[model samples]
Each structure stands twice: as structure tokens, then as C-alpha cells.
Target: MKRRTVLRGLAGSAGSIMTIPALAQDRYPERPIRLVVAFSAGGPTDLMARRLAERLGAHLGQSVVVENKTGAAGTIGATEVARARPDGYTLIVAVSSSHAIAATLMRRPTFDPVKDYAGVAVLGTVPMALAVHPSFPARTLQDFLRVAQDAPEGLSYGTSGAGGIAHLSGELFQREARGIKLTPVHYRGASTALQDLLANNIPIVMDTMASIAEPYRGGQVRILATFAEQRSPYLPDLPTAREQGLPGVVSNTYNAVLAPAGTPASVLATLNGAVRTALADPTMQAFMASNLVDPFPDPTPERTMVFIRSELEKWRPVVQATGLSME
Candidate 1:
């Protein structure tokens, strides 16, 4: 009889403890929620976060505010989110490098990417196009490679940041083209690099289509190829890097949301629902396409994890070759 009583007490305690978080989740978002972006406002990530916030508010019946915590190549913001109270009140919008590349790049990474956070769902990838200045003489990808092979010196290209996707793309292009030598010029952001490209200060730049689409259309820059798996419908006339013979050059900039580790699973489900609702709207799709973002196929937990892991593995070699740094 004593043992039976003891067992019952323990089971009751266990049940209550499990029920607490579930109950709290049911009442979650009784207040405003904070969505942290690891970069400055107006960047691709921030723009997407704001759009999601607007639609998520309608779905959740709560305000989702976006806060930019820029600096240290997104480290400051990521670290903040990792340490936040896991009450579902605070979350983060992360990118490819922030979670994957930063994990290995930073000498003393602030938090473990997989261990310290729970992925919400991927937002999508921002497609990029490789371009050069109009004055560069080579009008074709083949012609450019031929010239690059012949010179292999003083040729240079610009990327958003050192050890970033843009930089890695440039490096991968160099490695694949074999004999095409180019110096990499790193900028704090792609905007800065684009400015130099416009002035003819830099010969080449690998950046997002959204960032350079207008300029390219206006003849301010010459697009070499789109770095996507397939030709973008929006830019249907352009060929993918792979189709142009650079098989290793197709890449995209990814964006996703993640909650601080230990957030209640029930809360996560509710938040996921809001994300799905927002991402499914046709209006959102049009907006993303206009901005050169390819809306992800599905925003589910399983898909998000698979995407992250695949991206990590895909870029492992590039990251190793470039030796990118967070500092």
C-alpha cells in the first residue's frame, strides 16, 4: 500500500510538470512578441521579418515586433536570441551564414547553432546573379573565362563580407574555373560593393538579384549568370551558372526563424501555424518574387531541419577553403 501511494505521487507530479508548459502555451502571446533580426533594418532578412510580422499578427492575434541587433556579423543578435528566456516571447530570424557558417567561422562562437535553439521554419532563399561592369569587354561567360585564364593576375571581384556566402561563391568560381585568378575585395555589405561596381572601381560582384536587378536591367551592370538551381522565372532569359558550365556555382542566400532553446513545444506549434498562414498568402508570394526571394516549398519543422543540415554539409568545403571569420 505504501509503495502504491509513492508511485501515484510521483506520477501525479510528473503529469503536472508536463502540463504546466502546455497550459502556458495555450495562453501564450497574451502580450507583444519580439522578433530579432541579426542584421540592420532594411536588409533582406529585416524586410522579410517585417512582412511576416504583419501577417503573423493577424494569425496570432498579437503584435510581432522586429528588432535589429546588428554587428559582429550577426553574432550580437544571434547571441541575444540564444540567451533569451524560452517563453516563446522572443525569437530570431537567422540566415545561412549566421547559423551554419558562423558556427565554424567564429573563433569563440557565442552559442551552439543546433544545441542552443529550435528552428521554426525556413522563410526562403534570396537568389543572386553574378555580374560584372559593362566596361569589362567580355560579354559572354566563356569569353570572360578565357580572358581570366590568360591573365590570372590583378583581376578582382567584390563580395558583401569576408567569409560570407558571396565571398565563398567568388572563391568557388575561382577554384572551379581552374586558371582564372582573381583577388577578392570584401565589403561590410553588398550595397557598398555594388557602389564600387557602379563606379567601375571593381570589375565584378556576386550579389543577390534583388540588389542588382534594377541596375542590371538599366545596363548599369552586366549579368553573367544566375546562381540558382534553375533559371528564375522572373529572369527567364538568363541562364543558371551550372548551365553555363560552372556546375559548382549555383547557390542561394537562405533565411529562417528560430526560437531560443527550451521554448515550449506547444508554443512552437502555434508559432509554426502563424508562419504557414503568412507564407501561404499569394500577396506574400508576389512580394517575395518582386524582391528576388524564392518562397520556400514548405515551412515545416522537418523541412527546416533538413534544409539547414543540407546547407551546412553543402558549404562545408567552401567554408573550409575560404577560411571565413566572424571576427
Candidate 2:
């Protein structure tokens, strides 16, 4: 009877001890959380982060502050977040350049995109488009390939920058098409590339749907193909590269939230719940649509990992093929 009593008491003590950690985790975000945007203010990524911070802050009952830590093609902010505490206080607003492409592009990377962080939420995906200035000869994908194959010294396409998703999209497009040879002309930014395209300095430009929306509406540029697995809802009439016969050319960049690896699972669940709730809001839906982002309803860490792995696989071959590396 005495031994049984002792065992029961020990069991009760262990139960209480385990509950303490849960109690602590349940009290997470007692203070404001910092959201790091690895791009400059007024940029697409910063805008998305700020919008999400507002809704997330409201849901968490805590301030979710967005700070721009731009530089090194978004590595500065990413490194800062990767080194922050795993308490879910500091997180990063990651994009394709910072999270997916940088994994294979950077020659001397200080942080590992896969190993150093845990996913909090996936905001949405933005698709890349192949557009030609008004004066370009080809108006359709079939015509564009025919023109490229026979063009003198090959045709050239401008991208926001070398090794960016758009550039990789172009590379993937060329590889999949076999005979379509398109040279890349890297620019300082997408705006500059789009401007050059508008001015007819560049015959072709690979840009995101968000950046191409105005030009596409004004008929200043012809969208030859969208580089997504499916057609964009905003441009449902436009065909994806896959539908146009190049099935291996899906190049999309995602905007997501991530925290330093080892963050408590409870805290991750809280964040994912808040994000999924915000995405389901009608107003939020409108905002994402306006930005040309397709929201992922289920924003879980597992989904984020699957995306990261798949993107790495897709971009790795392109990077190797182009030898696109950064110092």
C-alpha cells in the first residue's frame, strides 16, 4: 500500500511538471513581435509584410512590427532572423530570392534556408510572366519560339536581376523549349527592366504578374506565357507555360513567414492559426488579389517545408545550368 501511494504521488508530480511548460508556451507573445522584411520599404515584399503584420497583430493582441533590413539580395534580414531567439518574437518575411534561390545561388552563404529556420506561415505565391514590348514580333508562344530559334545571335530577355526567379524562369523556359535560345540581360530592378521593355530597349522581359499588370492592361506589352503550373486567376484567359507545351517551366516566388529553427511547436501553431484566419478574411482576400498573389489556404510548417524542398530542386538545375552565383 505504501509503495503504491508513493508511485501515485510521483505520477502526479510528473504531470504537474509537464503542465508547467505548456502553461509557459500558452503565454507566448506577452510582448510585441518583430517582423523582419529583407527588402526595402515600398517594395512588394515590404508591402505584403506590413499588411500581414497589421492583421496578425490584431489576432495576437500584440504589436507585430515590420522592420526593413534590406541588402545582399535579402540575406541581411534573413541572417538576422535566423540568429534570433526561437521564442517566436523575431521572424522574417521571406521571398524566393532570400529563401529559395539563395540556397543555391549564394557562393558563401552564412545561413542555411532549410536548416536555420522554421516556417510560420505561407502568405501566397506570385507567378512570373514572359512579356514582350509592343514592338516585338511574336504575339504567341509558338510564334515567340519560332522567332527566337531563327533570330540572329538569338533574342535577349531582361530580368530584374540575374539569378532572380524571373531570370531562372527564362532559363527554365529555354531549357524546356530545347530550340528556343534567349539570352538574359540582368537589370538593377524589375521596374528598370519593365521601363526598358516599354521603351523598346529590350525586346523581351521576364517579370512578375504584379509588375506586369499595368503594362498588360494598357496593352503596352504582350504576355507570351505565364510560368505557373496553372493560369493565374487574375489573368484566366492567359495560358500557363505548361499548357503551351513546356511543362517543366513553372517558376513562382512565394511570400511567407518564418522563425528561427527550434521555435516551440505551440508558438508555431498559434502563428499558423492566426495567418490562416487572416487569409480567410474577405478584405484580406481582396488585398492579396490586388497584389496578384494567390493565397494558400492551408499555411502550415509542413507545407512550407514541402514548398521549400520542391523549389530548391527546381532552381538548383537552373542555377547550375546558368552558373549564376553571388559572392
Candidate 3:
């Protein structure tokens, strides 16, 4: 009887061990998920994360909470997510600055943008707008160029920070515009940059359309041109830099979702599906449209990874040329 009992006990223990992973897979998200935004609450990245979290929570049947961990050009929050458990509960809103630009710009990057995290879904892409205060002398791109060329010191432009996409776009524009140099005035974020522009502290700014949309519409700021291959649907009348004789000056920033590397494939798939559904919703589309951001053509993890890799490669030389460091 004792020998028979021992055998049964061993069999039960083996069966339980086999069922553990299956149970975890079945109950993927048994709790609320945390979406980390590496920027401040009012920034574009945080806005996108909050909007997506709302619909993602509905689709996943679990609450999705957004936690802002702003600092170090968005690396603080990204590092937090990179070191998180690969259970799909913790994710990060990855941006071009935090992932692509920072990878090369930062002297000592805390996380490997590509290796430390697995792509979940791409939220969208927004073009950088070259805008100026309404009171500024230049109203058109030509006028701005002429002013920049005539000025010995060049035109001053404000950016969110030194190593961000906005700063890079300004640099690229200067390189492509020929004889047009821009003195960069770094601010804490786009909002602050916009504030300085409104106050006439800075003559121009290169920032996301969403950041300047209200001011542009309110007649406080004027958008001279967009840094994109083509005109944005939201600002259809506005011409792109390519159309304005700066062919290679196109720059568009994108936002994406990422999970810690080694996350279960099933969990990643579930998250991707939820993101796709959320992005397709009409309300989400409207929000994106209002912000002058285009929905990503493909929101899948594989596509996101490919896009990220391409971006990283594309920006490596650009960052190197700038010799910008965040150490």
C-alpha cells in the first residue's frame, strides 16, 4: 500500500508541473497592465499611450494603466519596461527619440532599443512642422529661408531638447536648405518650445503638428512647412519640405508599443491584436487625424520590429554627423 501511494503522489506532482505553463497561458492577463510613458504627461507620447490604453483595456478585458516615468530623454521609463517581467503586463510607449535617436546620441544607453524589448504594435507617425510665431517676419518657407540666409547668425529655432527628433530635423533642414543655418534653443519639451515661440523668444520651432495645432489654428503661430515626403492629410494645404526644394529633408517621428524581450509569443500576439482593434476604431482614427498623425500601415509586431530596425539604421549616420551627445 505504501509503495502504491508513493507512485500516485509522484504522478500527481508531475501532472501539476505540466499544467502550470498551460494555466499561465490560458490566464494571460490576470491583472491590470502597466503602460509606461517615458515622457511627461502632456507630451505627445503620453497622449498616445493614454488614448491607446483606454481601448486596449476594453479589448483585453483588463485595465490598462499609464505610468509616466519621464527623464533622461525618455530612457528612464524605457529602462523600467526593459527590465520588467516578460509577462506582458508591463509595456512602454517607444518613440523615435527614446529608441532610434537615443541609441546613438546617448553616450551610455541604459537599454538596447532593439534587443531589450519586443515590438508589440506601432501606434502612428507624425511629421515635424516648421512653425514660427505669427509676429515673426517670415510667413512662407521662402521668406524664412531668405531671412536665414541674410542673417549672419542664422535664424534661431527652439526644440524640445538637444538630442530629440525635433533637434535632428532642424539640423537636417539646415544641411539640406543650403546656406540656411538654424541656432537651436533647447527647451524641456515641445510645449515649452511652443511657449517660447508664442512669446517671441524664439523665431521658429520644429515640432509635431499636434503640439502646435491649437496655436496654429488660433492664429498665434504659423506653420510654414512640414518635414515629410508628402503633405499631411490633416494639413492638406501645407506643402512638404520636399516640395519646397529641400528634397532630402524629410523627417517624421513615430510611436510604438514594446514589451520586454522573452515575453510569451501568445501574450505578444494578444497585445498586438488588441492594438490593431483599438487603432481601427473610428474614435481612435479621429484622434489620430486631429493630431496630424497617420496610422501605421501595419501594426503587427514583425512589422514594428522591421520599421524600428530601419529607423535605427537610417538615423545612425545622421546622429553621428551631428556629434550630439547626451552623456
By TM-score rank, best first, the candidates go 2, 1, 3
- Segments of candidate 1 deviating more than 4 angstroms: 1-17
lDDT of 3: 0.88
Candidate 1's clash total is 0
lDDT of 2: 0.87
Give a tens-digit lDDT track for model 3, residues 103-193: 7888888898889999899998998889998887887888889988899977889999887889888888888888877888999878898
**In model 1, which range of ten residues has the least summed lDDT?**
318-327
Model 2 Cα shift for residue 234 (angstroms)? 1.2
Judging by TM-score against the true structure, name the best candidate: 2
Among residues 3 or more apart in sequence or in different chains, the pairs in candidate 3 whose N, CA or C atoms overlap within 3 Å are none
Better of 1 and 2 by lDDT: 2
Q: Name the regions of candidate 3 deviating beyond 4 angstroms.
A: 1-23, 134-143, 199-201
Candidate 2 matches the true fold with a TM-score of 0.93
